[model samples]
Target: MEQIPKIIEKVSPALVSVVLIKPNKEIQEENQEKDGFVELETGSGFFISDSGLIATNRHVVFEVAGDYWVFWNNKKYFAEVLLRDPDNDVAVLKIKNQGKTPFIKLADSTKLQLGESVVAIGNVLGGLQKTVSSGIISGLSREIMAKDESYNKVFELKNMIQTDAAINPGNSGGPLLNLRGEAIGICTATISDYENIGFAIPSLFVSMAVAEIGAKTKK
Candidate 1:
């Protein structure tokens, strides 16, 4: 409790709501010419670099056709997908900034213990923004199967960090922070039939994704 406020203050500024806007299929089919983007889904992400690089789950921004916009610090900005790792359920996005945006530091997840305290921050249910939840690391190096009925796909998420944090819908892609307010994992999924059993992509994978992005940027 003593560290919650400080963690929120230091990290909330980098957290952003990820909104996916797609063409209204129903409206288009009825009119045959109607055109407008509708809010398809909402998730959470965090800036990982001052240059506007963002870290999120690939599922958050994985629409075949849509526009991705980010709401940060009460301002909305257009974002583009920069890198994606579907197997890991990780994605990186880029936004235009004047090089003044704050970012979250990636912690060494290898140092995390099974009982270490952690916090999760994200938009919940596509409407509740900046919701925070805290818990201790419940498990590590877990293997889970995530099924997407909409896309008829099953993703085998490996080496996940399991926590008791309340990760509701729309919390995907958000950051799971250590007590120091450093991002140690990316909140990725929760079992609907279970309680306090949320999972996160360990920061080690995040570091690998970021490194891949950097390598691509250099080319």
Candidate 2:
């Protein structure tokens, strides 16, 4: 769309790269090619609330061991896990005392139509940041199986938003956005062998996660 570039600039500030760090001596031995770099850029995420609540895929933070953090605008912030939805591939994390942060608005996925234009923003392959891909909603209510690398098990994901946007390893948990810059889904998985085929967990799942967190805060 003609207005997509403006939306990208407006929403890019809320995008983040989620990193996982584990204290280990062997980390140096394992990643010699990376020059002793131990941190892993695991996935992408976006701020969903001005208070610093971020929405990402559950599988992104599924590792039980390792501290999670996020980088936005070249600044690092320690992230605290709010919830890892047991039934959905969605999760929420908080950065304390954030004051105010840019966030993307979540949209209703139910109204999404096939052939509608969409965009995917993510850390492509965990290396490229601020990566943007444009596509259209090719399907809806799709069910697919994806391996959760954290558990070495395959699970079926349902009611997913199907898009043609380019997605890679690190794109998981990033936002699948509309031309308005509203997040319509969380970029989740893609078939590597296929072109123009990517799947996202619907934004409703993100909304559910946010609602759960809010419910807990009031308790």
Candidate 3:
């Protein structure tokens, strides 16, 4: 409705673009070509709380084994991985220097309905930090394959909310939000042959991951 723009504006501040850097490790092997130590891969993420906690895909930051970085509102800051579950492809990152930021609450994925309008926000090409796309719920209760066997569950993610929201390569790990600006899903996957075919990790999964991170942080 008329509240769409308002809701987007409100949540935009919390959405972030996560950049993974694989610092070139020095090697002793011959015929080694050395480029800059930092190589960049882009993805998106969002804030779940005001305490500098953020959620993103584990694959996005996988194998870095070095420094981690994130971008929000065009500013670059260093971050550290608080926890990661290779099985679920989710990771929790913490930024030490981040100031107070707006965050979204997780919505019940079980309640999501088809044809509901939703917005996707992410950094598409590492430069567009908060790009926005729109679509409607396309289906539910779908499954997606993880990149590797580390996620042994086959990820039969229940109550999925599908959309035609123009998600692209860099859109992974971003927010899939309802019209009310609540996060209903985590931008995760898509069909490459089709336009606007996007799938998201249901928000309930995000809630569980965040709760796990919270519990770990408290100890």
Model 1 ranges off by over 4 Å: 23-36, 124-126
Instruction: For residues 27-85, write the lDDT of model 1, one tens digit per residue.
Output: 45554433465665788899988989889988888875668988887777889888778
- Residue 203 CA displacement from its true place in model 2, Å: 0.7
lDDT of each: 0.85, 0.84, 0.75
Weakest lDDT window of 10 consecutive positions for candidate 2: 28-37
The count of backbone overlaps in candidate 1 is 0
- Write one digit per residue (lDDT tens) for candidate 3, span 1-219: 677689778887888777655545544344233754453567788888887788887767765565667777677778888877665567878887667767888898889888999988876444565677888999888766544433344444445568998776656788888988888988877765777778887888777887887697699
The collision pairs in model 3 are: none
Cα TM-score per model: 0.91, 0.91, 0.82
Model 1 / residue 153 / CA error / Å: 1.4
lDDT of 3: 0.75
Candidate 3 or 1, higher lDDT: 1
